[model samples]
Target: MVHKEVADHIRSWRFIVLLALIVLTFITSMYVSLRNIKPAVSNISDPDHLFLYLKLLTTTDNTIPPFHVFISFLGPLLGISLGFDAINAEKNNGTLIRLMAQPVYRDNLLLSKFTGAMVIIATLFISLCLLMLGGGLLLTGVRIEPQELLRIATFIVFTIVYVSFWLALAILLSIQFKQAATSALTAIGVWLFFTVFYPIVVNLVIRAFLPDPSFLSRDEIAGYNEMILNILRVAPGQLYADATTTLLMPSVRSLGPLTMEQLAGAIPTPLPFKESLLIVWPQVSGLLAATVVCFAFSYYLFMRREIRS
Candidate 1:
């Protein structure tokens, strides 16, 4: 019964539609990036600016492209939309009771739904990633470095966990909210709070606390900004961005911003990518763990909910 429910859920159009959108986004991003790229020019167009152009095309420069930003910002919205009605819709249609009448257990039903949704999510995420890689090869004809490919794969996996956080939140709300629309809206509102409104609120709080303009020195002001960001970094988006910078930019040792001269001085002597990964692994692990913790809480909430007949 559990397997059947998982299979039927995967066959649904909602899952298929998300898969299509993921592929479409992958193609669109690659096409636009390839189209916009300028041919490599040897003549110095501002020696300072030359590195920026090279970084854009290089594998390690993980600056969020259009495809990346879409996945980071909008992927969670899709997850929430798919899951917000997972429970409530069935209850509304009177199918909940009918399903319960079968020999299946409630734990099996809930577990199957969550597992199936995650399977579809992982499939869509990986498909989009591979599609982007193929498109990049066809358009630019550039061979992707193995390390770069691994970094991209890591980014995609992290993205799935990030989106799953919102999906879990939606499932938790669905258990609480009874009405599908209300559950969906609540999930979106929470998304907005984490993605948009929370940052604004944090800025406001910082500004209010540091009202005097000339009270702090340059170093003190930098310290204040760091403090604000540290507090706000509790959000998954911020954590992901921090982790991504470490993955994409080999020079990012500390989160502190440095001038070009300072950056040059601080560059590792041997510049081994493994060293870079070692430096950033803790940050990456933290973000992944936080994502799992959020979903685990949701699972606990879901299992405890009373689905009234």
Candidate 2:
């Protein structure tokens, strides 16, 4: 019974649409990145656009092209959308009672739901990443080695963690709201607040509170600017970005000098993978724990609620 429910959920049209969207976005990103490469410098007869491309790719941010930024923002939103009604919808359809009457344990239902959603997320995330890797190899003609593969694997795992955070939030909302639509809307609202509006609000507050003094020189103005930014670093986006930098970048001599340009320049290092893991292990674990906590709270609400027709 549990397996059937999971399979039916996975086979829904929503899953197909989500999968298609993921692939389309992934392809678009690769196409744009490859198409936008500047002409290579003339040198010896042997020209390596692939190596030059990857090197240049990580060395700087694309001011005109912002696909990477979109991925970072959209990944979590996708997770939340998929999960916002995992439970509430079943309840609404009068299927929850039917399922609970089966031989399967109550625990199996919840576990299978989470597992199914995760399977979908993982599939799309890995597919997009592999597409990026395949495109890189095709353009550069460079063979991927064990180390490079390791970096990609770690990055994919991080993406899963990031998405899981939003999924957990969705589950919590679904349990709190009886209606699926309301749960979804609430989840999206929270997503926008944290991912979009919250940062803008923080910036406005910072500007209002710490305005640049008209009397100050350029250096003083820079100091004031840095002060405001440092204060804003307390925001969730800043913390997540910091954790991502520590995980993805090879070396970080100082976090103080971080700017948009600096982050773009910071590429994955060839350092011991475990060392990078140790640095960001806390963040990775913290996010996963938060996800678990959110779901646990949902479980409490869900188990205690009275179901009615």
Candidate 3:
């Protein structure tokens, strides 16, 4: 059942469009990185010393956004596209009720759909990462260090979870809305609200309620920034940005404001991989919790839903 669902997803035109868009964005980012990388590499004494290969993923030429930024924007779209029709289309066409009439259980069917979509999403991302690594190696001759690979692997896993949260949310929408179009639009609407309007609304609310930080003492300003940041992190994009920024940029020591005392003897160097993960663990957990909650709700709704032949 999972295999059949996977094949169906792979054969869909929507998958083709997603692949094209992602690959185009990847190539554009890669080109920008390659163009700006030579100068950066020449400036360093040891070009391939540490996270050199990561430069391909994190490096940017100002005008074009880096690779992960593109993923943050487009990844949800891919998830929503795959899951928005997971149940409704089949039910609308009279196939879902019939399929349930057969030997397969409802839980198995839903799990298969989720797994199949995730498999395709995972495969596409892994392929792109490999392509980036290979292309970067060929062009710059910078060997990928062990730490770089670990960081990339961790980044890929976090991304898959982040995207899966959207998928689960989309599936929940699909279960609630009878029409596939309604579910798809609803999912996209939620995405747009969080992505575009939420930040503006947050700023307006904060300005109206909170005092100006410039007038506050140093300790008060730190508290103020942390408060705003916690509010912003409610949005999934902010959570993702926080986690990914920590993962990709090892030099980022803290997510929040640091005091003069804390920065007094701080060295300007990359953090250990485990330390990076520790710093962003909360954001990662938030994404994971969101994904699980969305999936659980969808599962319950589908199990209790009444479908007629």
Tell me model 2's lDDT, rounded to 2 decimals.
Answer: 0.65
On TM-score, the leading prediction is 3
Candidate 1, superposed: residue stretches over 4 Å from native: 1-22, 38-65, 211-213, 258-264, 268-283
Reference-based lDDT, each prediction: 0.67, 0.65, 0.89
User: In what order do the candidates fall by TM-score, top score first?
Assistant: 3, 1, 2
Pairs with steric clashes in candidate 2: 50-140
Q: Which stretches of candidate 3 lie over 4 Å from their true place?
A: 43-50
TM-score for each candidate, following the candidate numbering: 0.80, 0.76, 0.96
Report model 3's TM-score to 2 decimal places.
0.96
Clash counts for the predictions, in order: 0, 1, 0
lDDT of 3 by residue, 59-131 (tens): 8878989999999999999999999999999999999978988999999999999999999999998999999
Total backbone clashes of model 1? Answer: 0
Clashing pairs in 3: none
Better of 1 and 3 by lDDT: 3
Question: Against the true structure, what is every candidate's RMSD?
Answer: 4.4, 5.4, 1.8
How far does residue 205 in candidate 1 sit from its true spot (Å)? Answer: 1.8
**Which regions of candidate 2 deviate over 4 angstroms?**
1-6, 36-67, 211-240, 243-255, 258-279
